[model samples]
Target: MDFNQLKQELFDYCEEINVQKVGIASTDTFDTLKQRLVTQQAFNYQSGFEKGTVEERTTPTKLLPKAQSIISIALAYPSKMKDAPKSKKGDRRGIFARASWGKDYHDVLREKLNLIGEFLEEKVEGAQFKAMVDTGELHDRAVAERAGIGFVGKNCNLITDEYGSWVYLGELITNIPFEPDEPIEEGCGDCNICVDKCPTGALVQGGQLNASRCIAYQTLTKDFLPDEYRTKIGNRIYGCDTCQVVCPKNKGVDFHLHPEMEPDPELAKPKLEPLLTISNREFKEQFGYMSGSWRGKKPIQRNAIIALAHYKEVESVDTLIHLMKKDPRPVIRGTAAWAIGKIGREDAKQVLEKAKLHEQDEDVLVEIDKGLDFLKVHTTT
Candidate 1:
């Protein structure tokens, strides 16, 4: 069995399946990543979405006992959408980050990884494999960087020469000892755009992120968004792309190789007002296929309220009031209360006062009071 020939064949197979790039890495423990993770934990910088302990994350052998090599794959997604609808006055919209533009990338990448696994199974008897995507314990960026798939940029994204950072990464830890590829030695080279432009200063420095402060992470939380980020989140309902959008490396690097990764403009930038009152089943039927919907509709709805506030969409004020009065969830009710305050129309104070009399939740009451505060100066003028 010639391992070198098999490696070439794997590359060919990846091309046949439309996977943008592929590389091989050894099963050695990621010592550097383990130390960085320690710092991230000490600073409470983690997004709380990470799976597995530090040991399990760094040691591929822990995931697959006999793991001899790891194969890293990249699938480039479009950075720009064609015929995207614009967000206008009465019909304001919330934007989903490019990653959520198409079908859930997790499903797409997993299918590709499974195809790779089956191909190897056919070639090597008893070839064990453990596949991983973004959700997997092992850091996809770390694995991809080590595998020569790309270099880790200042934004902590694996950046390939062909695709910039607009790539979805996945890996397969296998017992096959494929020859390892050379790690890319490139870097961001003194570019501080992403860090400098991070909305909430989530990028503590280049490559270091305080996930709790990141708009993207904040958008996924099931609670009220911090007040400081309401304006910064702008129209973004799912993820923040300020870091990637500002990075010079990503300029003009959009790739539309996979049709499955293309954006449906309507879904990617859906009307924010409709999102406020969307039923769970309706949300599932419309957006469940997108990766951004993984957190379900609550966060999206909350962010939509925030986006309405960002735009001060006066037309949605009544709808916001309905949610404040009728929604069962405190987070949604409280968020809508906050949005009403932020939008401070002439009748807002009267509307909020009426809701305040019926509100039971202490937290919701606090938000209602905040809403009334915004109305004091608003109504007087």
Candidate 2:
């Protein structure tokens, strides 16, 4: 079959498999991508992506030339569990968004895309193809946008008329050319709710996300919460979803069609008190398959302590006291002190003072003193 006939067959097959948006592009696509990455200031691309940095390493492989066409796909994943907990003080349980609560999407999407790649090779004459989930060097989101899959939102996420911004993207670069699809128009006209609500001001301007200041990046990337951002972090212990949650366009979207996107029961709304006490083995066992679990248990545990501090519940004071003296990580100890201070417990000052005398680390000692000061102010009232 000729290129047009092959393109029609490819489109029909993808539609049969529920894949959204497919396109073709040359190997020179990378040149345009490199320039776009430079304009976006994603990172200094001169060295060809950092060893393990997400910005550098997020997309792992590039397809070699002789692949004349690039086919991209997007799968919607919009399962709503519940709203953020309302208590300003208490356990303040938080659930993972449906998209992130299950096994990583990369593994799932790559497996499916590889199957499609195998099919293409078997059917086409002397055909060759490479598939990628979000794990490829190609700009899958940008390509999907250009292919009329969706428009890019002010949150810097792809938003589809059918799925809003709740779809996962994957692609297949093949040695057959096909007609390229037209891009959708931008849907986020005059709406800046996402920018206004960002606690860290991560959205600098029209749909731009500053990774350095993003809370999602802060919670997942940094070994410990920076002191300057701790107070503003609120209760997000893993990744932040505030921007997606508040988007006006996301309303009334039905998630019932995507049963696979449903969140795990344990993660739907985990109790922080129990979460704070988990052993390393338990942490791994519970979250081993999850995206948040890849960073290991320490960062999440530290953020949990910080969340408890922000809640300032009297019930959390005992938990804070226990963590301060016994937790293995200094970051956790520091957050525990901060939590104790937040709770305004009578014993907070005494416990911090005792910890201060024994605390050799200057940073932990400073946090202890801050806890002590908070307690002093509360008791004098």
Candidate 3:
């Protein structure tokens, strides 16, 4: 059987299926990635979300025993939202990053990968394949890079010429000995825009990231956010795009190729006050379709509180006070207490004093004290 001809056929099928980019790579152990992972682990720079051991992550053969080649696919998502709603003074809103704008990419990419796997099975008598999206043990970016889908940028994102960094990546590991494509020669040379502009300095160096300091990572944490990042997170509820948004390579790189990836203006940038009080059922009904909702409503609600504080949304003072006193979650109650203080309403001291009397949680009391301190500083002046 002519594997080269079969490779071309697979490529054609990918194009017909509307996959934006496709490339083939040999199933060689990723030595450099293994080293980097080890170093990242030692320095505590790794995000705990990573799946599998370092060996399973870097060695394709471990994922699929007889893996001979890997096929990488990328689908471009829209970077620019059309007719986005404005975050007016009284009705301020928070944004989900561009990656989370549309329907979840996991479901979309999984469907595409399954299609490719079926196609390969039909063509080859005994084609064995394992497909993976972002959650798989194998690093999607490493596989994509080796497959020549794109070069890894300083922001640690895979940047393709056709779609820049605004793309969802997936891969299929198969026993077919498809010829590997050459890695892209392009790289971010002396361009430090993403590094310089990272809100939390998550990008330690060009290609390394301290996920702990990353606003994207911080936004997903269930606990109360640290004091320093409460203001720095701005109005982002899920994920941070400062590094990607500022990259020159991504300039004018919006793509609307996939209908499922189109953003709904109101949902992607919903009003902050409503989010603070959104019931779990309502939160699910409104945001369940989006990828950013994976962490559920708590983190998003927490970020919403921080965003209201960032704007000093005086209109939300009443809602903040309600959350401070009535919310069941300690994190929410504490975050609301802090935000109320930050907003500094004329009666903030009174409300906080009342909350202080009944608050049982030690952490909530600490936040209430901080709120009173803010009032104390303002009242004396």
Candidate 4:
């Protein structure tokens, strides 16, 4: 079969599989992306979730010896929930970002890529294709941009004309010499809303991100969150969407293209109180399918404690006190003690004082002291 005919066939199959967009790119080295990676490394700006070395990420042939083209695919997800439940006062809820709203996109994208590989295998005899999603060495946004699927927006997300930046990206490298699509020259122009509205100012002038300062990256960390971002994260338990939410390109773009991408109102915005006490088995059963649960329950529970404190919910103080006194993990214990202080219920000082005497961990002791310090002059409610 000719290259154009194969591409047309592949596009048809992509439509059948519900892939929102598909584009072809050449196997040229990503020179601009390499320079940016070098700068990011020099400045200590990487989120540490990045995989592989710089060369492995930028050079396509390194991953596939006879690589002639790359196939990029995008799947659109919902930006708003249908009957989204609100996070009320006593029955407060913590939110998972839209990316983690449904079944893990990594699994969804990988499954689709594998199916594409099967389609190509049937069409091109003895064709070799290697597929990957977000966890892959090759930057999905860079590949998608080169493939003409989208332009990398100032938020550093691949923004498609149809789906905005609300699409999950994946790609496969193939030996088939398919015609490459022209990269979009359309730009963000003077629109700086995403950069200006980053909650923690993680977005630099031209889309470079200091991942260390990003709340989205901070949410996945297992340690006690930094003091600066505690209030900034608000009720976000998994990731932050401030950048995307503020972008003009993303306005009025809420696509429910895939059933698996739909958010379950309960799991996506679970009651903060129940999450604080969710057992390992229960947590896995309830949230294992969601991408946000990859770091396990520790960070989510800690964030839940912080969200409760954010509301100054006196009712949650009892749960926080239990976590402070009994939770084995120092991160959980320390964070809970801090939350108890922030809540400042009627018995706050007394409870913190009791825990201070018995806490063995120096870190936990420090947090307990911090809690007591909150009650220095002002009386508790």
Best model per lDDT = 3
lDDT of 2 by residue, 1-381 (tens): 677887788778877766654555434444444554565565422223223333332232344456655677887775465453344445466445455766677776776687677767777878877776664666676667766788778887788887777778887777676676767876899999999998888887756667778777787753557777788777676777778778887877645444555567656556677778988899878777776676787777777777777777678778778888888678888878877886777777778888888778777877887777877788789
TM-score of 3: 0.99
TM-score of each: 0.98, 0.87, 0.99, 0.98
lDDT of 3 by residue, 135-208 (tens): 99988888999999999999999999989999999999999999999999899999999999999889999999
Q: After superposition, which runs of candidate 1 have C-alpha atoms over 4 Å from their true positions?
A: 379-381
RMSD (Å) of each candidate, 1 decimal: 1.0, 3.6, 0.9, 1.2
Least lDDT summed over 10 consecutive residues: which range in candidate 4?
372-381
Error (Å) of candidate 1 at residue 177 is 0.7
Question: How displaced is residue 45 in candidate 4, in Å?
Answer: 0.1
In model 2, the number of clashes is 0
Q: Where in model 4 is the C-alpha error above 4 Å? A: 377-381
Residue 142, candidate 4: C-alpha displacement in angstroms = 0.4
Tens-digit per-residue lDDT, 1-381, candidate 1: 999999999999999999999999988999999999999999999999999999999999999999999999999999999999989999999899998999999999999999999999999999999999999989999999999999998888888998899999999999999999999999989889998889899889988889899989998999777778877889999998888998888999988898988999999999999988888899999999999999999999999998998899899999999999999999999989988988988788888899989999999999898888887767678
User: What local distance difference test score does each model get?
Assistant: 0.92, 0.70, 0.93, 0.92
Model 4 over residues 1-381: C-alpha lDDT tens digits?
688998999999999999999999889999999999999999999999999999999999999999999999999999999998988878999899999989999999999999999988888898999898999999999999999999998899989999999999999999999999999987789999889999888997657999999999999999889889997989999999888898888999999989998999999999999999999999999999999999999999989998998988888888888899889999999999988888888899889998988989998898888777777745633
